[model samples]
Target: MSWTVWTYVVYLLVTVPLTVWVARTLSRNGKVFLEDVFAGNDRLAEAVNTLLVVGFYLLNLGFVSLFLRVDSTVVDVAGVFEQLSVKVGVVALVLGVLHFFNVYVFSAIRRRSRTEARRGAPMPPQAQVAAYGPVPPYAAPYPAPGR
Candidate 1:
């Protein structure tokens, strides 16, 4: 077969399995975090985890498919390697970026949950004012009496 065909084969071989492996890894490990974030709601956590997995598959596979085509013709084995390198490299980079994004978002949710748990239920606005005492008149944007 031609180098172009080989390039396509290699790209598919590399990206498809990589995508599946990443999705599975994330789904498996993320369940615990999701459960914690949902505060022991296992059903809700499972549902959200499934949804996230589906979304991850769609995005990664779509990107892989879209990026499969080489911009230039592969002239030889070297060209094939070069093209594959660029394609697979981009896919790897995108995968890392998406993974990091998911981690960051989930971490934020977990952190917020921890904070709320520590603080208990939120205080109402009036309760806050009452607890802290009324806002001083001088604290307002308007000028003070002597000013």
Candidate 2:
């Protein structure tokens, strides 16, 4: 209905893809933080990236819509340009936040998995019981003295 609405729509159309592209580029580069957060699994990493992109879309779109509703009216070409500048600036900010969040989350997963691996594989349920003491009656003991 207003020029601000059109500007907001254009802002989303341009910046959401840019944000996703930046995130994907960072993913492809595979830094320690990204690998740590994604647990070094390529499939899981891509899936997490996809989720972040979706969240970015939702967040940016909502922000643009909200900004449109605010009292941001411009009387002429200069005014429209001013609104565009503000809109683009905000979009850039949202993208930065999404980029950092993606990096932070994946790094956490990678670090957790690395810690687990360093500790050696965990004992299976039965092995755990055997390691600590005897098994519970329902668990059935090992081979009863080998026949």
Give TM-scores for every candidate, taking all chains together and pairing residue i with residue i. Answer: 0.80, 0.57
Best by lDDT: 1
Q: Kindly list the per-residue Cα lDDT of model 2 for residues 1-147, writing each as its tens digit.
A: 566666656666766576657655665665444445655666766676566556666776676567554365656566667777776777678767766776676567667777887898667899777779974778655676667
| Global lDDT scores for all candidate models | 0.92, 0.65
Q: How do the residues 101-142 of candidate 1 rate in per-residue lDDT, one tens digit apiece?
A: 988998899899888889877678999899889987668777
lDDT of 1: 0.92
Stretches of candidate 2 off by over 4 Å are 1-13, 16-40, 121-147
Write down the worst ten-residue block by lDDT for model 2.
30-39
